[model samples]
Target: MLTRLELAKDWVRDAGNFLKENISSPLEITEKTRYDDLVTNFDKEVQEQLVSNILHHFPEDKILAEEDDEKIKFDPEIPHLWILDPIDGTTNFIVQKDNFAIMLAYYEFGVGKFGLILDVMKDKLYWCDSHKAFCNQKELESKKMSLDKSLLGVNSYMYRTNSGGLLDLSHQTLGVRIIGSAGISYGQLLEGKILGYFSNLQPWDYAAGSIIAEKIGFVTLTTSGEKPRFNCREQVFTAPAYLVSEIQKYIKS
Candidate 1:
């Protein structure tokens, strides 16, 4: 019998392979909110496959996935839950054919146990299970970068809000990047390519990545500096603890 952790890892690998097999085919795409926010047939197909696979293997486990509107409101008191993002960078997958991910996280009684973020094109996977994080099996460490030295990610939508706090954080960081995918941005953070990521993200987008970041000593919290609540309607930010502290000053100032 596969241990729970082993089952999670196998599911991720199987899903990644499924994605790669279909990557080259023409996709049936549709707009979600706008032309920029897209949903592909593959996205739904993959989500269904993942949800089915997990449920079949672990009928008692709760699952929350991106394509479904039915939220799995598990008792935080429950021992096991699975969070999945079948295709994290759907825009990139549709237009650029690269930079998307299959992300998954496992939690035991509200505590994160494992995280997997797979870069489908690069064939690289980032993972952490209790002890350490690895990129393609090479162990990774999160280094603290000062605000001025940090590379920050801001959702393009935030640019429209004109919140002074957002503007100030953008100015303080070493640079700002608007990656179309939250999973990719979080993957960059895990690989130490970027110092911080701030966005108004949904649960599937952040759940898996947050687990990896927290396991490797990065901070995952809301703008209010509280632990993020999954399946909620609130926005959250994940970053290095020092950078988060620096950004919070702007929010208060």
Candidate 2:
């Protein structure tokens, strides 16, 4: 698993560099479910490159990626699975050319073994295995802070709609941040910059980040305070275990 983790780290770094190199180049962008939910030519290209590399090195491992709808299956028979989000903050990538990330997670027999998230613009590689989480290869210590004393990350959609009482929840925090990228948000959490983050996120969006965060004492839960299912989208709340119940109180049914 450690060897595979190293290989994944290398692949994600390579992909991140590709994104950086092409930031100034022209890209063919298209909307997915909404105008703001975008994908670019680079997104597809990066996904293809990472997927091809994974298959080449680990042919038997199943792959689940954001760009390919056909491979979005959770097969119990596949002991090893790789999940990839080639460009996590597409809107930010298109507009700001920064704040985006590349995320990858590996699961063996339904247990998360390794996870990687590369903050492309900053060149920070946040990764974890079963035992520890690190940023740029430096281990992160566990952090615990009260909601009233720490900043929180809430997605724009949820904040705008006040979904699940998020507006009220924000009032309890020191402040709120909306990064628009789960991977980047997770990195902040791992670094103790934010207390927690909640958003309706897909598997690839939260999988890698959640794995890395959990290793450092965070727990990922559904809005209603259940473990999230990996097969579909869920309102995921990730934070230190001590803060889960307080955050869940504001999550309305």
Candidate 3:
């Protein structure tokens, strides 16, 4: 598993560089759920690269990716599965040209084995297993922090809605930040920049981060108590277990 994980890391980094090189190219973009929710040619190309690499090495592994409908849909019952987001923050990739990420994770019989989130512009990769996580070549180990003193990562639009009285909750934290990318936000959390990150995310958005959260004793849950399923589009939240209770409290109120 370690050897395979190392190889996968290399694959993701190479694919990231591929996308970066083409970042300036004129990309054919189209709207998905919203005008801002975009799918680009680079996204498709990068997804193809990852899917091909993984399938060539592990021919039978199930793959769930953002851009490819023809690829194998995720199957939780499958012995091995790879959940991938070729470009996690497509809006950032398209508009700001930064704060985007390429994310991938490996699950075996529903157990997370490895996860990686690569910050493309920053050139940092965060990967983890049950034992430890690393940023680039440096090992990462973090301590839990209280909400009052800890910064949080959340969607500003959701906070604007004050849905579940979240506006009030943000006031209790050190500060609230909206980075527009789950993978990047997860990286910040791992680096101790934030105590927790909450977002309404799909499986591709949160799968890799949730696995890392588990490995590092961070919390992963949904507002209504749904667990991460294969390819479900739903609201997702992850932080430390202690912080989750407060988030749920706010939602319930």
Candidate 4:
């Protein structure tokens, strides 16, 4: 019998394998809202697979997945719930064929228990619990980095359009990276390659990574400095502590 954590990890690995096998093939793509926001057959397939697997194994738990139109409302009284993003960087998956991820997180009454962010191309899995974070089984620790030494992640659309208070924050960082995928940017933050990442992101983009970041002793929050609310419909920005404060100042100025 597998524990819940074991089951979650296995599901992620299986999903990643499924993605790798299919990623190179021709994908049927369609635009959602705009050309920059994309969805593919593979994305829906993966989401369906994950949802079915989880529901089959844990029927009592609630699920919040990106592909579904109707949100699965959970009673806060329920002890367990799962949040999933079948493919975090759908546009990247459609365009570049790399730099995308399968993101998952489990929470207990709004308290995060475990998180998994699998970088499909690199075949690296970033996972963590309350104790620590690991990349491919190697323990990871948060490193201190200042604004001038930092590399920040912002979406190209946000940077170009100056949407949602992003332009001022972009200018303050040492350098800005329009990575197109929040999952990839989150990996960069965990590996110490980047100091911060901020953008108007959805719950799927930030839930798993934010839990991992917090576990490893890094600060994770919205640009407004509020802790993220799980199953939220609002857009959010996440980053390390120093950058959050710095960017807040920049936005004010």
Candidate 5:
């Protein structure tokens, strides 16, 4: 597990470097569902590299990736599964040329064994192994602070819905930030940069981050307060325990 985890880290870093090199290249962008939800050719290219790297070391592992293609498969008989979001913030990558991330999580029999999320622009790599969560060489501390006192990361759309009460909770925090990438947003949580993350994200978006969050004792749950399951597309919230409770106080669902 240690060897595979180390190799996963190296593979992702190399992938990030690939994205960095192509940032300035003339490119094409298309909307998957809407203009706000974008994908670039580089996204597909980087994912191919990631898959190739993983398969080189562990070809038997199943792969679940955002760019869904016939080439990857899910075989329950296989003990290892890798979930990937080759580029977590495509808009940021295309528009700002920064604040994007690469996320990958490896699971063993449905349980996340290790995860890695790299902030490509800043060269920050956040990962979780069997025992700990870290930003580079620094081990992260478990969640331990008041919700209102902690910096918060939230999706701005939460303010559009009155029933969730996320809008109200935002007012109670030190501040709210929307970094566009769930992987990067959760990385901030790992470093204590944000006290919590309140966003609607799918499994690939949150699975890797969840592995790190769980290790650090951070809570990953539904806004209505439910256990979050990985390897499936669903809405999820990863945050401190207190902040979750605070948000749930107003969440009608």
Candidate 6:
């Protein structure tokens, strides 16, 4: 699994480099479900490259990814599965040429084995395997901090709508940060820069980050305060176990 994890990291790094190389190039962009929900040509290109490489190395593995032909449903019967978001923040990549990420998570027999998130411009590859989490090559240290003493990441939509009392919850935190990218936001959480995060996320959006977060004593749960169902889009929140109920109090419906 370590060997595969290393290979996966290499693949994500290559994808990140690819994105960086094209940052200034003109791109063909389009909307997905909404005008603000964007996808760019690079998004498809990166996803294709990563998915192709994965199948070449592990032909039998099933993939659930964001892009053409790769957005298939997960099948638990499959021995090996990969969840990928080729460019996690496409709008950011297109608009700012930064803050986007390449994220991938590997699972075996329905259990997570490895997860990788490469912050493209920052060149930080945050990753975790069964035993540990790291940024680049340095191991991460975990510290427990109270919600009130920490900044929290919130989805702008949730904050705007005050969905499930998100507005009230944000007031309890030291501050609120809405980083448009889940991969980047989770990286911040792992670094102890934030105590928690609440957002509506798809499987690819949270899979890699959640695995790495869990490796460092954080728990990713549904907004309802139950275990997350990774097979579908859901409202998700993540924080240390001690802070769960407190944060969930205002957000969980």
What's the TM-score of each model vs. the native? 0.92, 0.96, 0.93, 0.91, 0.91, 0.96
lDDT of 4 by residue, 1-253 (tens): 9977788888889999998888789999988879677899998998998989898998988888888889776446768888899999898898889999999988898788888999999999999967989998899987777777777777776667776567766666677877778899899989988777767777778889888988766666665567656556444666666556666775431
Give the runs in model 3 whose Cα sits over 4 Å from its true position: 70-74
Q: How close is candidate 2 to the true structure, as a TM-score?
A: 0.96
Off by over 4 Å in 1: none
Q: Write down the lDDT of every candidate, Cα atoms only.
A: 0.79, 0.88, 0.82, 0.80, 0.81, 0.86
Tens-place lDDT per residue, model 6, 73-165, is: 676666999999999888888888889889999988778888999998998999987999999999987897876788989899888889868
Model 4 RMSD vs true structure: 2.1
Candidate 3 lDDT over 108-207, as tens digits, reads 8877888999999999999986688889988887686877898888877668887545677788888889999999999998888988777777788888
Better of 4 and 5 by lDDT: 5
Cα lDDT for residue 17, candidate 1: 88
Report the lDDT tens digits of candidate 1 across residue range 1-253.
8877677677778888888887789899988889778999999988888888888988998887878867776457878888888899898988888889998888889888888888888888888878888887799886866777768777776644734366667777777788888889898888877777778778778888888888777877776667777856445677776566667876421
Clashing pairs in 1: none
RMSD (CA, angstroms), candidate 1: 1.9
What local lDDT does model 3 show for residue 196? 77
Candidate closer to the true structure by lDDT (higher is better), 3 or 4? 3
RMSD (Cα, Å) for all candidates, in order, is 1.9, 1.5, 1.9, 2.1, 2.3, 1.5
Question: Which stretches in model 5 have alpha-carbon errors above 4 Å?
Answer: 69-78, 229-233
Judge candidate 3 at residue 70 and give its lDDT.
Answer: 59
Q: Which scores better on TM-score, 3 or 5?
A: 3
On a 0 to 100 scale, what is the lDDT of residue 68 in model 6? 55
TM-score, cand. 1 vs. native: 0.92
Query: Which residue pairs clash in candidate 5?
Result: none
Worst 10 residues of 4 by lDDT: 244-253
**lDDT by residue for model 2 (1-253), tens:** 5478888988999999888888999989999989778999999999999999999888988999999968657665669999999999998899999999999999887778889999999999999877998999699999657888999898878877888788889989888998989989998988999988889999899889888888888988888778778888888888898777777788764
Index of the highest-lDDT prediction: 2
